[model samples]
Target: MKNTIAERIQDFLKQFPPFSMLSKEELLKVAGQIRVLYLEKGAYVFEQDEKCHDEFYIVREGAVGLYRNSENSQNLVDICDAGDLFGLRIMIIKKNYRMAALASQESIVYAIPSSVFKPFIDENKEVNTFLLETFATHARNYYTETEKGKRIDNTISIDTAKDLSTLRTISYRKKPLTCTADAIVKDIAMEMNARKADAIIVVDEQKFPIGILTDSDLRAKVATGLFSATAVVTEVMTAPVKTYAKKITVAEAQIALIKNNISHLCITKDGTRNSKTVGVFSNHDLLVSFGNNPSILIKEIKRVKKIQRLRYIRKQVERLLTTYLEQDIPTMHILNLISEINDALVIRTIELSLEEMPSQPTVAFNFLVLGSQGRREQLLMTDQDNAIVFEDVEEAMYDETQTYFLELARIVTKNLHAIGFEYCPAEMMASNPRWCMSLSKWEEQFRTWMTTPSEESTLLSSIFFDFQSVYGDADMSNQLSDVVFDGVNKSKRFLGLLGVSALQKPSPLGFFKQFLVEQNGEHKDTFDIKTRAMMVLIDGARILALYHNLKGINNTLLRYEKLASLEPNNKELFESCAKAFRVLLKFRARQGILHKDSGRFIQLNTLSKNDKLKLKRCFKPIRDIQEVLRIRFQLKTFM
Candidate 1:
């Protein structure tokens, strides 16, 4: 037989998982021996309680449903789609199959003998780690009996910045078991023991830290007769406790601890010894905060004097995101926390760009983040779509002012690229001359798009209309928004144009509930989840929210919630649309985290039957919403 089959197997295998970690020769070897099995729809590959097979299967076509058989019922546990591997839990655990695999449709599966895959697993560290993590996450879900996949280990990376603004900064003992200057050494020791503290802070009546007495102080001073047991605490205590600000970073705390040769650093409001004591940072506290913390990273970004340092910090944020997703933290919290860090990075980029300018900005300016960043839902590093709005300048100065902001935008966008946000392919970013403009120019631009409402103008409006102030003057953004709403109010044609744009893509599923997977390009046969499912919800929400004159809220989910309140008759549909948006977003984030890309493409065969059913459920509202848009806006007349 030709090696075409084996090569095809390798091509599919190289795209996923532990198999991707395998070398070409090794992968080919496994592929060559792969036993191709064909099964009719509803045919069983293995049953629960049956002894394990020597090989595990990867779907070549169609789908397989994995069902867990309990005493009374068989529950669908997972669905394996094309390119998804299954029947391996038995191989991993050396036990009988606890779940039964049945062909969900007429399917082709390539069974690679476990013996062939085992050698690679043993030799490749990444392969081993992937298997361990995947198995652990799956096992955690099973044991918890919850859909939440795995509890992420928080200490692994630094980006775990949950909404720090919301989290109460942990309070610590500020006075710190202090004793007066006249207190006896024995009294200090007793006080330390009473408080169960390793050390005690010595202070004057004003509650300011003066010195510290530790277990070592008693051991070296009183125990060795360097001081009598009856001596005053001042005679034994080490003078001047190290101090820091309440906003001290974990790294700064580490450096302070190392530099001072001290265990605790007194925390004050102003970060100096002169301020009133707010709290204390012990070595233990330093260790605790050193783990994944978004606040620490944000603090680091503010201190970074160079673009390269900011770039390094951004990478740490990405690593943190990977860990966060792996842990399955609440998706909303993850989104909020990451958005803050991203905002901080953008702000830092702007600050750095200003420092490099020939002179300060000619006028007040505001940087506007459009699209996903505006929505505060960007998880992965996507394109940077932004604009600039400088203060209204005299007609004579307008061109120069626009040039100045455009130059600034170029620098900021460049730094953003250095830190991993891909440059927008369509040149939609602030660096683009078309997007960078003075306040009046931007207002005019928005007015034209809103009034004319051509295909290009509608597309531009779809993206730019969601602009949120990222940095600089807020009034400029306010004026722009006012102009947009005014123009939108005057033009039914514009709203209709937007409605047609939202309905550009058809529903993601066919009548039989099969995914309309891509038919061409590098991602052929893989479903483009973003264009097919996610964009539908995002575009629909934007159109409806703008049509309703909803302002401030750009998030698709929140927009839909607002829409629900505005139109009570359609509340259920709007609510379902919101829920569907969240579900699709979570799915895309999980899939993106899994594959390390945009999570746009999904292998339909890889989804479990339940997941497919859940995804299909989202389309009902999508179809209904499109119909509403068509009827209300009379979009068909425009078509």
Candidate 2:
């Protein structure tokens, strides 16, 4: 009489997407045919290249690992935890499974046959749309346009299911002021003044955007006397305007403006210049959306002649970080946005420093950020680790050039300190004469470090090897990277030394699975998460990436993702390491924000049971990844 099991299935299914969009009756009908299956860890629900099972499955408990096999190895594409849906590909195509689904942990899963789900796809638009978005997100570049269209009609929509506030649809200026291409520049300028508008779109007879004219256009062309005020707008207007659909998200709009190097974007009906124009999205529009708008802060950083103003902006950045963390925004998104803002601060500081110089140096040089900041992973207001590398000058002029850059580095680092980044206690900064050098000297520095590894050189290499150019000539950074990789590629002894450095940090957990807190010093009875947990992952990632010669990838999370792709045999471990790193990073940031410090050391007693469990969960991967490094580098003898 009572189908309690089916009813329970509906409860779980309705909590997730696609099924969440389905009506009660529809979900019930689908749940009625669902078959509940239990899987032991390492058991596969579906195998790659096998014929579709006429069913799609969802994780009801534990986790499922989706793997794509290639080159005799299975790569983890994605891990689906509780309430996560997988196996949707069967509903979209009549082909074999492109990926295999296996239980990553002992799990319970619900399988709903396509026969019961196909009718709902045809009948419900929301369900269809949700599935379409899910498919696009998880697509591995294999699905054809026709195959994708089989599940839903072609229509682009912003994925609001994501957590980032920037992903929300933008509130752009509707009913934009428009003008014809033939309108006189004087008339357009006068009209813009009367309307108090900074910009106007140039539209064709059919209202399709052709170009745009802004105050900048008038200032550069009319005020500069390049064109007469009475000249036609076409003579001065910026042609080939960038257009996006009305549903463009703030993130998309921001990217369009930045990438195009424009102040405004025209919103069109069909997302093309040929389509009917609807509204305008200006740089100002972004300012009103988020209180701590990154673009606006960046603009302010660049515009502020005084360095003290940057300190205020940096404070706002911390507030933004707090908001993102409180709102549970994706950690990777937070990391990237903060990195960009931090970089803007450093770049602006460098720009202002150059202005204070007696005269511009003649040779090309690069301003590099070392350590965490260099990897684009710095979150909180941390210590500054930077260096300077200038073009090699004739031996006679070398001293003069080095002195100029050293002075420049001193100013930049000092200003950066004012903006909240503390000076590195080890004095590992650009201002250090040993760090500010010519390109050839820097190359030699890396060669020496790689050719002959020691405690001091290894420690310095750990910081300097992650150096990234935040300002100045990027070619210099690339050249240094080439030398480092060249030296590392040939040095087995150095790899072993680095591997030893990674294993130096003991396991975070003890024999009883209890956290190993600090034993003495000022941090007594506290946990040094940075050194024990985060660095273990960071070091493992860096060493593996270096061993694999993965150039230009410095961010810890990205390094792990790239490693997973490159070494599919160890994909699960790398993916776990990446996930663990994200969790640990976010945890540290939250702690730092709460205590108003770097969040490096944690008082274990302060943590709630759940918080402690989450921290412990992240440490397992740290231990597992360390073992991989030990075996891979043959560190037994060295240790």
Candidate 3:
């Protein structure tokens, strides 16, 4: 009864439902009465039509397969892995087991008493909904129509007989009316009316779309006397119209609309404004083409009320990103759009965690996204790096306040992992006690790092300096940034140390002009594009920008642009760096799409002759930029 194995089982069960919804005492009670069942590969826990056991099971280790018995064969319904719950349908409905539960591999499962968990199913709405949904998905896949009606009367699952992929690709109207920028507003309105359209594209003399004249533009700019009816279309049109290339998927088109808060996307022969206009994609068209819209995704995220539903949405976003890349959408635009959705997921996870807390937070707090995510450049699913900054509290309440935030951060980060963002391998997440801190303590920590520049301090500074507020009080994050920049402004030595740190990777090219590759570990024999190439540019940009007290600029390309403006003498060098960085990013994005990994590793054998040459071309600017960093910071002495 007092075995460590029982305590381990309790710990595992305490995270999942209906066990999670139970009080600690009630959970331990069930835990005490639990039996540990170990089964080898291909062993069945219970066969179809067998009487229900007195308890349901949670997979503690390995895998379990839930299979349905047909007239002639058994069909696999679902695979249950670690942290997944199974065998609960019988306990919930009080019926004979309709499906056989078998261990797909050597497995350990916790058998929790049905009597102890039953009360929680009635009490926790979220737990109940989760169980019902899981049962519905399994039943829809396995059960016959007759069994569905009788076995799960209250369950709701869409069992439509249509290919979901086909539903997502249905085409819509694209031939929209167009007018020259110099055309009169009244003529544009007439063109819209004549074509039976709600909007008219305003193009330059080259036939490239430059602006749009929609019904709202007409009412606000023309009908309101803000502009004359005889005014040129450019006077009333929305300039720099959102544009997309031909062959965009319904998901990309919808995401564009939501991100820009626009109803239409100007389709061009090429994606930029320099190309001829081809067609138009409207929000209405996207809705008709794909039944699901951005609002539906947001609604789903909110309605999730559980981590599993959020995981499903995250998978859908991955599918969306894959489609976007296949269609050759701009990487910057894709990064911005996907990062927004990722931020929203983190925000929602925080909201859900708050609900799970026993009470509201004792004080206001801000959630900070660090490293690549903070810079809004995370394209692939990477480890999450984050920290929490809470408002200062009295000395008496400091320890308890910190404890509360740590607990909240744990829940938030765990849920983030469930949604596809891997846990930070270095433990840089908010869940780490060293990171979850009060504002004053964080300020002191930053000051310590800035004033004393050790190898570890410089490394931590490089990561923490890029912090962005993903959720909570923006003022807290702004204050922390102010503290960081103020410290850097005073410590010239520290800035030089940062510059030296940024130069550690050297050039990404080898002596024979071959691409430099990783030396060891899991990624041995691979080229670490992120550490060797991308981070060199990113770290250099951050250090130089901070030295100049630059603000509101994070992207490496944009930082170079700002630096060019500040240092006219080095304008060409900076501009070249900007262009090379963009080219390298595009290359990495394309490779990531092809390999479905982080794009950090490159297979030299897979590269075409042209790609290898193009990659080599970018290395020149990388070497030149490192030289410039060395001179400007006088890093020769440190090296």
Q: Which candidate number has the best lDDT?
A: 2
Clashes of 3: 0
TM-score of each prediction: 0.61, 0.58, 0.59
What TM-score does candidate 3 reach? 0.59
Q: Which stretches of candidate 3 lie above 4 Å from their native place?
A: 1-299
Candidate 1 clashing pairs, residues 3+ apart or interchain: 79-608, 81-605, 81-606, 82-605, 152-327, 158-292, 245-271
lDDT of 1 by residue, 1-639 (tens): 779989988998876667777889988998998999999999999988899899888888888888887779987666666666777664455667778999878899989898888887788887765554344223211321121333323433335433221112433456566667899988778877787777777776676777778777788789998899999888888877777777654444544564465667777668656666667766554444444568867876777777755765665666577657656676667777788889999999899999998999857999999998898889888888999888888999888888888888889999899777899999998888898888888888888787666789888888888888979998889988889888878877888888888888855887777788888889999988788887778888888887888878888878888898899999999999888887887788777755556788888778899988888888888888888899999988988
Candidate 1: deviation at residue 625, Å?
A: 1.6
| Model 3: residue 119 alpha-carbon error in angstroms | 28
**Model 3 per-residue lDDT tens digits across residues 439-525:** 999999999999877999999999989989988899998898889889988877888888888788746787888887877888878
Q: What lDDT score is found at residue 450 in candidate 2?
A: 87
TM-score for candidate 2, please give it: 0.58
Candidate models: Cα lDDT each = 0.77, 0.82, 0.76
* Cα lDDT of model 2 by residue, 457-529, tens digit: 9988888899899888999999999998898888878978988998998668899999888898988988999
Model 1, CA-based lDDT: 0.77
After superposition on all C-alphas, the RMSD of every candidate to the true structure, in Å, is: 14.7, 22.1, 18.1
- Residue ranges of candidate 2 with Cα displaced over 4 Å: 1-292
